[model samples]
Target: MAIAASTSSPVRMKRRSSAHYRLRRRVRKGALGVLILLVLAYTLFPYYWAIVSSTKQGAELYTTAFLPALNFSYYRQLFDNPVFMGSLLNSVFVATGTTVVSLALGIVSAYALGRLDFPQKRVVLMAILMISIFPQVAVLSGMFELINALGLYNRPSALIVTYLLSTVPFTTWILTTFIREFPRELEEAALIDGCSHFRILTRILLPLMGPSLASTGILAFILAWNEFLFALTFMLTDENKTVPVAIGLIGGTTRYEYPFGQIMAASVTVTLPLIIVVLIFQRRIVAGLTAGAVKG
Candidate 1:
């Protein structure tokens, strides 16, 4: 009887210990979730404030606390502004052109680097990396001169070409990493089936790389859309200005007594497209980023 009691006592203690561990774990997990929520809120609060402020009227905007108050006048006024539409169109054109050009070149260069081995391959790649790492400010003077020589200053083409310099190298690096992960066996089998290199790449590899391409394209689009410096420098004319430059114009122009509402409205408008893009490509971006992190 004594032996049985001792054994049962140990079992009860073990059960209590397990319960305590589970409770602690649950508490820790709840705390972690709260921390994440706080971090997300902290990061997103500024954009949220912008959206709210944009919706308020000029009078209400200045008077109210940094919270949203629903008003339609601000939205209507923003559209009624002549330069708003033009700036939006310019942004669309530059972002689209930059994405298309960068993706086309990035895909070809990535494929070459991934599949073909040759002398000076490493050297060429190193050059690309070095150029990519160079600050945009460092090359601004040369780019400005080249744009002037080509008679593209203050033109959409100037912005397009300049944005390529920012997008291409990073796109190439990302796509090359993605391409290297493709199964060599598939390419070999395609060759065995008498498929040409172009056919294999176009028909087989490209389709498989859709996610990576989407992720890179989305990033390039965002960069081009949000770009301010080149747009400001090259597009001195209001007619050719992109959204960022347009926003700057609104902020600087003192024709209006108060411009905060208009500026905030423009900020909201410009940010909407980027938010939409992220929503569309969020999954692909996550997958592309995480694919190389873990070993199969």
Candidate 2:
């Protein structure tokens, strides 16, 4: 009887212990929820402020509350500015050119590194990775001289080529990692079907890597779009100035006289496209990151 009673006591104690553990887990979960909410609010506050300022007229912007006013005259005025349109177009051209060139080079280089066994492959990959870590300012003078030698200064091509220094290594590394994960049997089967290497890459591997490519391409585009130093140095004409340079030039009066409202409006406009891109490929970006981490 005592042995049976001791066994029942242990069972009862285990049940109570489990219930207490569940209660503690629920409390921790609730606390974690509150912490996440606070983090999200903190992260989003700057964007919220920018949106509020964009909706206000210039006069109301300085005088108004943190919340947005019902007026949107500043947004209208910002669009009316000629520089805005010109800068927007320049940004588009530069971003598109950079994306195309960077992706083309990255695809070729990544394929070579990931698939082909070569002497000094590790050395070449290490060199690319190290080059990517070098500061842009450190290479600016060399880039400028190179651009001048090629007579490409003040052209969109100059910006595109310069951006490759930043975009190419990361893109190649990411895509190569993704490419390596593809089953070797698939490529072998393609070869058995009399598909050439180029045909297999173009028709099979490239199609499968669309998501990884898009994620890297969009990232390159955004980097090129937001680039300021090279854009300022390479592009001299007002018409060639990308949005970052344009925005910088817009606010150089006295601090008191800065066009905060218009700046905010332009900020919102510039950020809108990036926000859309991120939203569109958010899943792909997540997948690409995961794949790179696992495969690389």
Candidate 3:
């Protein structure tokens, strides 16, 4: 029985290593290709539908058409509306403000934490990380009260300040890690050449840190741009809405269904800048992340 079992196992193993096994492998490859296509369809169908839908006018929308209409009426209406355009400008202002402020504060803080050794530095870093992970909802009331107290209620600046709660910590954390990987010897060499610490960071480090900075900045911009809760809560007036809040302001048909054509057109419009920005700076993002505070 033992001899028979040993011989049978070898036969099975040989079968697995044979042309039959190759056929199974091909079958799996074909199955995987089909599965990938299905997933691609599932993921992309919405965008495709949006494109198709955006081309139709409100009247033409009741009857579904798989083929896109060349009508630009929805787009014209969107651009012609002052409220929508104002909201778009407001989003640009808030998002830009947040990015600038966060990066300004983050680089200095990150440099100190990353390079300058101090007492309880690790503790401080851990605290920053912990704060970054905290639920935004937990501090919603507190932030709202503070904004009101600061007399910034219903202002674009209020959103700018509040967004820091989300953007700054993460920015600092990433920048710190990247900075820490810098060569200590370079700083030493700069110091010996009578360069100030600030000069070293500005002239030597900042240029080298471009890719990471661009990546971090883009991420910050996206966060601020897409932020809905704070935009909705703070921007009370019709004139003060951002893209996300502005989209909600436009009502749907039958009080339940959204104006799909307009909404999708706005979506398409809003997403183009992000896609362009990312495509332009994507290469730098990878380089910056990998250019850590380490040297060979």
Candidate 4:
């Protein structure tokens, strides 16, 4: 009887230890879930408030309402304004042009840097990196002088040219990393099939580069779309203004009244397109960024 009691005592202790571990794990998981919820709420609350504020009318803007009024008169007014509509168009054109040009130049530059052996290759890459790290203000004066000298000031082309300075370097750096991770065997296989360098790049590599391109292109588009400093400086007229500049210039009914509603409405209008793009390309963006993380 004594031996049996001792054995049963050990079994009870083992059961208690197992239950304690499970309880601790459950508490830990619950805490982690709560932390994630708080983080998400903090990050998304501002955008939600903006969206809610945009729908409010007149004195309603001053309220602390959590839900939107669902009134869209502010949006209607914004769309009716020709200057605002034109700025939206201008932003689209400039952003799209910058994305295409940057990607084109970056892809070729990346291919050379990644796949080929050349003298001063590392030096060239370092220079590109340095250019990317330079702030817009640091280059503003020189860029303005170049634009004025080329008679491109106040032109859409000026913004595109200046934007390329920032976007191209980023695209080149990212694409170079991605291209380097590609198997050399693919290029060699194409070579044996009598494929020219250009052919190999266009046919063999480009299809595989879709994910990277989508990721980089969307980022470049966002940068150009939201750029205000260059746009404000270079685009002098209402006719050439981008969305950022246009939104800033939105006026109140009188000197005493601020157009908070209109401003919030414009903000929502401009932000939605970017959010949609991100959602659409989210998968590609994830795949591109995580391409070389795992070996197998």
Better of 1 and 3 by TM-score: 1
The candidate 2 region of ten consecutive residues with least summed lDDT is 287-296
Q: lDDT: which candidate is best?
A: 4
Tens digits of per-residue lDDT, candidate 4, 44-115, equal 898899899999998899999899999999999999999999999999999999999999999999999999
lDDT of 3: 0.89
lDDT of model number 1: 0.88
Comparing 1 with 4 on lDDT, the higher-scoring candidate is: 4
Candidate 1 residues 131-225, lDDT tens each?
88888799999999999999999999899999988799889989888888888999899999999888888999998887898889999999999
Give model 3's TM-score versus the native structure: 0.84
- What is candidate 4's CA lDDT for residue 164? 97
Off by over 4 Å in 1: 63-67, 251-258
Give the distance in Å from residue 57's predicted Cα in candidate 1 to where it truly belongs: 2.9
**Model number with the top TM-score:** 4
Order the candidate numbers by TM-score, best to worst. Answer: 4, 1, 2, 3
- Residues 175-236 of candidate 3 have per-residue lDDT tens digits of 99888888799999999999998998899988888888988898999999999988899879
lDDT of each: 0.88, 0.88, 0.89, 0.94
TM-score of predicted model 4?
A: 0.95
Q: List the residue pairs that clash in candidate 3.
A: 180-293, 181-292, 181-293, 181-294, 182-293
Off by over 4 Å in 3: 1-39, 58-65, 253-257, 293-296
Ordering by lDDT: 4, 3, 2, 1
After superposing candidate 4, which stretches have Cα over 4 Å from the reference?
none
